[model samples]
Target: MNASYRGGPTVERILPNEEAHELLGLVTEIADGELAPRVADFETRGVFPRDLVRTLGRAGLLGLPYPEEYGGAAQPYEVYLQVLEILASRWLAVAEAVSVHTLSCYPVAAHGGDQVRKLLPDMIGGELLGAYCLSEPQGGSDAAALTTRATRDGEEYVVSGTKAWITHAGVADFYNIFCRTGEPGPRGISCLLADAGTPGIVPQQPERTMGLRSSPIAQIAFDDARVPVDRLVGAEGFGFRIAMSALDSGRLGIAACAVGLAQAALDYAVDYARQREQFGRPVIEFQGIGFLLADLATQVAAARALMLAAARLRDAGRPYSTEAAKAKLFATDTAMRVATEAVQVLGGAGYVADHPVERYFREAKVLQIVEGTNQIQRLVIARSLTR
Candidate 1:
């Protein structure tokens, strides 16, 4: 799945197909023209820019991997990774919302029967947005230990429980709710497609996050929410596997986002270093500062490479869990380090909003925590080592 990239130290130009390059161009254009200008307003006020998401949908960037018949681009994972990377570079909140939306759409798209897939046209066409509900207050990274309960009735499943830290919770058009259906533990879980307006389905106030403010998080409660049995995605016991598979794909998205974040930081640091004079010379002219930029750039390249490798594995229909975990682990940690160093390179200016390095710094921290922590990623990789 690994193919050598051509031209320059900017390995991000590499992709599995030319379509990715074209898609990334659109992403960059949109980011620079639409999102970059509004980032300060959104991040500072913690207000979600819902209108921006619709714009992304209109651009056909919302659903890249699904079949074209469903209004998707039918792009491969490699191409999708680049899109995520580009989006993250401009605004991480937008990039992450797209990632989480895709994650939320997967169970119904891939595993649900034809009836569910039929929804893909409107769903992927940007008419509908989605959220995934798997984490509970007590669960966090211990997803298998989820406590959300669902009881079956004659023709429907009565869902009763709260889902915590749901991205796009109140704003999403649909939710892929994972709840317990059997005895206990992982095997008891199931994925149900619950519409946002369903009776008894409630979205609480959005949580004030440390960063990624343009993307809001909230808790959802299903108080005997009546979901038709037909709404179930895959089979009852397959939810655990379904969730894991979606997360595998999701980790790739996060990895790409991390790459973009690191790229933004590096670009800022390099540009600032070249302009800001220090000791009667440009800062970049100093070997110490030059070497730091070099190292940060190198790490960013490595992060992009790892994510692309995993994305290629996904395109090949191979086991990508270990590789995806590795990519997420490496890329996110790199973003954190690179963002911190980027601020250091900018000195006092970096710490302030006159430059976006501070924003990049704040945004990079969450990449390590969401989509499963780096600690959880290592466990997934180590467990797969025995296999």
Candidate 2:
């Protein structure tokens, strides 16, 4: 275990080993030197940081939890998530990109056939990027009702229908396509791994997002796109299960991102309050502002602890889906609240782009929506309790 201070309070981390400590230090260095400087420019221009993503992949930050034989670092889930937190503190888009790519690899790495498993090296190694295509325009939370259909053709499955809110749509080398294959309901779905360049696969224009503009999100139209039969992950009717399982881990990743974002906002607000004077004293010295900062700092710490608790359960091979949902729900909601208060602390400067809090405020919102909305997380936890 080691305690280190970044910009805000000292975070005491209980790492599994010395190697994990060194890995966090390395990630911090990369985040400061590589990610921080480019975030503003790339985000402002709505440019995807493809090369920066490649740099992370090359540095082994992209595949922290997969097996070493598959070119992954084989780190524990807890360590992998902390890496995401470190990256998100400097640049959230890149951290999210890493999380999505990791989620995209889960199907193949965990359930792919032998032939498709051969691609793990390239996918996990980050030589090839990937996308998870499970959400649809008509079916974001109701994943079982997804209308994307894949019919069996000679030696292939002809996929048709549109997937909405797909990250890395046009940029990924491969996509994990979850589609309907049988009768209506959860049992009808199947997963297919398809090459991004396959014919009839069209990526729509990127959405003009409020934040995380550096990471593109758009709908992908699969117009009778042909994917090999061998690309089917696990058995037919297993896609829904695979998708939910992946999201359990993905939610934890998002929780880590939220914690990092909130921590950054708190740190900035604290710094601003220390320097900005009001009534012949630093604003931070005032009881009104000091108590608010105290509450925000405590919330950030609690969120991090909750997220790490879920991750450790996962690393220990326990049932953590409900815990993951709880962490995601609490952390993201905390991020939205913390970021809003941070802006309030900054007054007028927070409303403008002059400070990073404005961006943080905007970015905090989508964390509550992605991976699974806060409402949906509540549903998951509720079901676990009753059942």
Which candidate wins on TM-score? 2
Per-candidate TM-scores read 0.95, 0.98
Q: In model 1, where do residues sit more than 4 Å from their true spots?
A: 1-12
lDDT of 1 by residue, 1-387 (tens): 000101112443756666667777778778878887787778888878888988898899888998787788889988888888877887888899889888877887789898677777777766688898988998999899998888999999999999999998888999999999996888988889888999999999999777788787989989999998889899997899899889999999999999988998888788778789978999999999999989988899899889989988898998888999999999999999999998899888888877788888988999998889999999998999887
Which segments of candidate 2 are over 4 A away from where they belong? 1-10
Q: TM-score for candidate 2, please give it.
A: 0.98
Pull out the clashing pairs in model 1.
Answer: none
Candidate no. 1 TM-score: 0.95
- In model 2, what is the error at residue 319, expressed in angstroms? 0.1
Model 2 shows how many backbone clashes?
0
lDDT of 2 by residue, 88-180 (tens): 988889999999999999999999999899999999988899999999998899999999999999889999999999999899999999999
What C-alpha lDDT, on a 0 to 100 scale, does residue 384 get in candidate 2? 96
> lDDT per prediction?
0.85, 0.92
